[model samples]
Target: MLRAQDLMTENVIAVTKDTEVRELALILTENKISGVPVIDGTGKLIGVVTESDLIFQNKKVHIPTAVAILDAFFFLESPEKMEQEMKKMSGVTVGDIYAPEVISVQKDTPLDELATLMAEKNIHTLPVLDKEELVGVIGKSDIIRTIAEGR
Candidate 1:
């Protein structure tokens, strides 16, 4: 069975947290990619920045509903969710909007498992790691190609 190492793109295009959002947009446009991994100064994967995150900047924010009960205020919706949306809308750098809770996979992970994870999580890009080291990246396109190739 094909594994993440067999399908992942070794020459990954990654960015640092300090990378400007504008530059990231340009990279994605030019490379025709949906997302890129964010790394630290030591080249450790930190997060991921995606087209969806960039689009969030232009989306309308949904305010959390609240009600005043006596002297206390009760939020009908998650205020933290609203705050996160607001931050993403006003973000200027990859660090400001990148998803830190990364959904990554190991190099030896089976393609079937990878596909299931991507489908269930609605993820377009997944980073592959080898013993805590970034090895490659797998995108939705790669999976599609694999399917087309009947692999």
Candidate 2:
């Protein structure tokens, strides 16, 4: 069986959470990648930033609907909330859009298991960690390549 380390991308491109959304989007486009792992000052995996996160910045609207009305009754919707979302959509940094709850796998993990995990979680990528330090990243494309090459 192939291992995560065998197919993971070692030359991983990462960014800091404080990076601007515009810059992050550029990085993703330049690198031809959909997402990037967000690191902290100490180079620790703090979150995962993706194109979807950045795209959401262009989708903020305060038009109240039925869902908004229902949420308002529970104090879940307010002008302040809309303002905050608008701010996030406009001037928010990658830190504001990153998904802090990241999923990862060990470098030596079995590829079969990793694939299963990916399917179950509906995730397209997984960071490969060695003792909590990022060593590589594995994506569905990598898995396909591995299968095609019989690696």
Candidate 3:
């Protein structure tokens, strides 16, 4: 079975928290990639920034419904969700909108497990880690290409 180290792209393209949204968009477009890993000053993986994050900027905000009863208010939806959406829509840098909870794989992870992780998490890109260091990245395209080659 192929491992993450065998299939992951070693030449990863990453950005810092301070990366501008416009710059991130440009990087994604130029590389034809859907997402990139975000690293800190020491090159440790901190989070991920993806096309979905960028698309959030253009998404319409759904206001939370609320009911006022006797001077008290009840929200049917999560107001925090709306606030987060608004922040993303108005974000200027990756730090403002990037997903901090990163789902990553280790070099020895089997391809099947990797595939399952991606599918279950609904993630298109995953950073490959060696301890706390970012070593590579795996994208959906990489899996497709590997399958095409019968690897």
Candidate 4:
């Protein structure tokens, strides 16, 4: 049976917690990855950062203006106007966006279970660990390729 070790990428590209968001963004773009595991000085997995998190980081909350009344004429209007909201979403750090609670799978975990976990959680990537130490990462593409290999 296929296991996490069989589908994981051993040479995983990880980043430190102190890594700047701009540089991390470049890393993600250059590697064409959806997310990366955040490690500390001792290489312990502490968090996970995804592209969705970065894209929506520090997004300004929109507020509705007022209630709208039906016009007697053919004119129309929408109630949830956002012209008054200020653009206060310029700066944010990875620490501000990263998910501190990470769910990792052990190397011995079965591939079928991994697939189920990924599908159920709607996650494309998961860290693989061996006794709390990051050994690799299993991405959706990796699982697909592994299945394609007739394993």
Off by over 4 Å in 4: 58-91
Candidate 4 lDDT, 118-137, residue by residue in tens: 99998877999998999999
Taking the tens digit of each residue's C-alpha lDDT, what string does model 3 give over 1-151?
8999999999999999999999999999999999999999999899999999999899877889999999999999988888888998999999989999999999999999999999999999999999878999999999999999998
lDDT per model vs. reference: 0.94, 0.82, 0.95, 0.79
lDDT of 3: 0.95
Question: On a 0 to 1 TM-score scale, where does candidate 4 land against the true structure?
Answer: 0.77
Q: Residue-wise lDDT of candidate 1 within 22-89, one digit each (tens)?
A: 99999999999999999999989999899999998999778788999999999999888888888889
Q: After superposition, how far is residue 56 of candidate 1 from its true place, in Å?
A: 1.0
TM-score of 2: 0.81
lDDT of 4 at 82: 34
For each candidate, C-alpha RMSD in Å? 1.3, 3.6, 0.9, 6.8
The residue-level lDDT of candidate 4 at 37 comes to: 93
Worst 10 residues of 3 by lDDT: 56-65
Top candidate (TM-score): 3
Better of 2 and 4 by lDDT: 2
